[model samples]
Target: MSEQLKQQFTKRIVELQKRIDSIHHDFANGRHADWSEQAGERENDEVLNALESEAKIEIQQLSNAILRIDNDTYGYCGTCGEAINEQRLAVQPSATKCIKCAD
Candidate 1:
């Protein structure tokens, strides 16, 4: 189970890293000749920035989860030091809190 969870976390991290790289590539190559198109791209910048930020934060959370798994502490809640539900972990592999602590 630990190996499986570690693989899952690693897979998710790869996916998020790809998304972040794609976002960075888009930002780097943003170019529009038309004024209206430039304005539209600028408008899209805000959305892209928000998305990039969200992806980064999720990546950090997943990385921390991986660390916990490595330290033999992955299934425990960070807040209450109780075992997190297996169902919850199945649903949210990156979860760091048990239901009681979450509430």
Candidate 2:
């Protein structure tokens, strides 16, 4: 991989990690607005929880990508051991499988 691409991926990973940390902080703080006394509070909490869960999954994927980069296996299909297409990686930096393998 080119230095520029590597930098971009690294930057994305850092941003994702920061977001994940923020989500963790929010969850840890038990952020709720008088839910016992307010209507729709449970729904709001559910939405926030769902968002946090999605962020966690994305963070896991990004972390794996960083590991692959460290292992010199980043742009390759995890299942078939083939080079992952650049376009796919550009669209989804956390992709673990090539198109065929993914299908």
Candidate 3:
């Protein structure tokens, strides 16, 4: 990877880490439980929990992407070894495939 791209990825990884930490803290404090008791609230809580779980999984993927960045493999598609497009990377820094391979 180019030094500039690596730097950008590192910066992004740091930002993601901060966000993930904040989410963890919020969840630990039961902040989302505030909505667990309104009308139709059980379903809302289920959806929110599912979304939060997905976010946590994505955060782990982002952390893995940071490792790949450090290892100089950040922009390579995991499925086919093609170079992942910069635009795609900008949209999803944790992506492991090129658009074609992803499709």
- Best model per TM-score: 1
Provide backbone clash counts, one per model: 0, 0, 0
Q: Tell me the TM-score of each prediction against the true structure.
A: 0.89, 0.72, 0.62
Q: What is candidate 3's CA lDDT for residue 25? A: 67
Full-model lDDT for every candidate: 0.88, 0.78, 0.73
Off-target runs (Cα >4 Å) in candidate 1 are: none
For candidate 1, the C-alpha RMSD (Å) to the true structure equals 1.3
Return whichever of 1 and 3 wins on TM-score.
Answer: 1
The reply for model 2, stretches above 4 Å from the true place, is 1-37
Error of 2 at 17 (Å): 5.1
Candidate 3, which ten residues in sequence have the lowest lDDT sum? Answer: 30-39
Model 2 lDDT at residue 101: 99
Residue lDDT tens for model 1, 29-103:
967999999999998888889988988888898888889988999989999999999999888878999999888
lDDT of 1 at 26: 92
Give lDDT tens digits, candidate 2, residues 43-103. 6657767876787787678777877888889899999999999999989988999999999
